[model samples]
Target: MTKVIAIVNQKGGVAKTTTAINVGAGLAKHNKRVLLIDLDGQGNLSRGLGCKTKARNQFTIRDALLNIQKGILTNPTKGILTARYEKISVMPANKQLDAFEHSLKGDLDAPFYLRRYVNTLRQYFDVILIDCSPSLGLMTLNALVAADSVMIPVDPEFFGVEGVEQIVAAMTDVQRKMNPSLSLEGIVIVRRNDISIAKRTNAKNLRLRYGSKVFQTELPTSVKASEASARGMSLLEYMSWNHLARAYASLVEEVLANGRN
Candidate 1:
């Protein structure tokens, strides 16, 4: 069974897309067939994988939603694009996704549109990673509905923790009403600065509060991540031996191991 994981944070700049790209790439490096679904209107995941939207008429998740709205189970195989790495594919997003909320407004089955679409492709990949927009709106709700687990990236700052809390509350509501199987896979601490005493203390306090739900791997603040994104490559490809790359590799291992049980 494919494990659908959403890399979500309602607050932007928390390394959400960075984690999705690298983690999906890391899993692919480990021979896991991974599909990265870009649900965010920003299209960062698609661009990070070296794809330019203007080059072609790429079928996106928006098309899938439209198909579902019409009660047609479209096999979104055309939407799946090959990534720069082996065993990794991507479902790119476009600016038109921003109009999805208004388009599906008042539709009773709106929340499950993504869930139904993802189900059609579940057998084709070992894992599906959703890069969601930074909001608790319709798009985020669809991602949540489609996912079995969620991995939240926190920036090792005060507001990041608050964002995690908000997402947790939203997840609780989602579980109660929409997808009961949805579970928080773990909290990933992104852009941590151990040299800063305040940041270190906050990271510790978060781990203490969240306990086992917090992932052991912490992504340090590194120029490598940004450089990788700018170069349209994963950190593993850009800086193979970097600490952040290794941390994401470890995260993939942890995710795979947890999914087995």
Candidate 2:
């Protein structure tokens, strides 16, 4: 049984896509067959994994959803395209995904669309990581409905804290009305500079409020992360010796441990 995890944050620039790309890579590095689903319309995860949107066929998640709605029993794994990385497959998203909001309108089961799609691929991979957009809209709701657990990446800033609150509230709603099995896998504090007293204090408060849900590993903001994405690589592939890569590696272990139980 594959664990479906959504890497989400209502706030952008919090390393959400960065975490999804590298963490999925890290899991694959550990021999776990991972499928990365780029649910964000920006297609950042698709590009980060070296997949070009222009080269994709009409068989995207959009088409998969339409087929499923027509009772076609479309297999989710069929929509996945291989990435440059070994053991990692991707369901690449295109900018047209933004139209999903309009496409799903007047459909009562809209929230469960992704859940039904992922159910078809549950046995094909060890994990399915959803790279969600930074908003609590239709797309995010679909990802939440599909996810067994969620990982939120937060920057060490005041607005990040507020974003955490909004995410928690949304999770609560999902648990109550949509996905009763939904759990918050962890809260990752990214781009932390321990030398800054304010950052350290903010991290401390975050831990105090969230308790063990806070991840033990903190990912520092590194130029290597951006450079790796620009070069169509993960941090582990771009700067294999960097501390950030090592941190993500450790984070994957923690995620797997939590997920297995």
Candidate 3:
């Protein structure tokens, strides 16, 4: 079965895109056919994977969504950019997506469009990862409705905990009203700085609050991540020996283990 995971946090700078990119890369490294869907208008996830978001010839996630909304007949694989060597593919996005939410306003079936779109892709991929925008808006709702599970990335900060609370509340709403099968994959501590007492405290609080729902692996702060993004490479590919890369590898294992359970 193809498993779709939405890496989401309603707050920015929490490494949601980072988690999506690396986790997708990690899964691909494990021989899984992965498709990354960039739902964020910022298009950072698309760019991070070396996709040309501005390419006029490329079919973006926005286009796909529009097709779904308008009931347009189009090839499902039309816009997917595949990295054959990495076993990964991308449905890119750009600033063109910024107005998508407003366009879907008051559309009763908006939430189901993404689910419908993703269904067409289920047979082609072993995994699909959606990189949500930094808000619990219509797009994220679509993602929540479409995904089998969600993974939240948090920096070790007070507001990070608050972000989790907000998204979890949204998840609860989604479960009750939208997708009853939606489950939380886990909470990940990103940009962790163990030397910082406050960060450690926040990490402890998160683990205590979420218990085993928190992943055992925590991604450490690293400039290499930014560099890798700049170079359009996964951390595992950019610097496999880096500690953060190793942590992400462990995270992939945990994700697979959770799926088996």
Q: Who wins the lDDT comparison?
A: 3
lDDT per residue for candidate 3 within 156-248, as digits (tens), equals 864546668989999999999989999999999887765678888888889989999999998898889999998887898889999999999
TM-score of 3: 0.96
**Cα distance off (Å), candidate 1, residue 49:** 0.4
Off by over 4 Å in 1: none
Runs in model 3 with CA error above 4 Å? 158-160
In model 2, the clashing pairs are 191-221
By TM-score, how accurate is candidate 1?
A: 0.94
* lDDT string, candidate 1, 1-261, tens digits: 789999888888888999999889888887888899999888988888876654466678788788788987555676788876445798888887888767888998999988988988888898999999889899899989999999998877655456678999999999999999999999998777656776777788778879988898888877888888878789988888998888888988888778877
Q: Write the per-residue lDDT of candidate 2 for residues 1-261, one digit (tens) a residue.
A: 789999888878789899999999999998889988998889899899887765646466676766766778644577688877545898888877888667888898888888999888888888899999989888899999999999998887644456688899999999999899999999999887656777777788889999999999999767899889888878988888898998998898899889767
Candidate 2: worst-modelled 10 consecutive residues by lDDT: 53-62
The candidate maximizing TM-score is: 3
Model 2, residue 58: what's the lDDT? 47
User: What TM-score fits each model?
Assistant: 0.94, 0.94, 0.96
In terms of lDDT, model 3 sits at 0.89
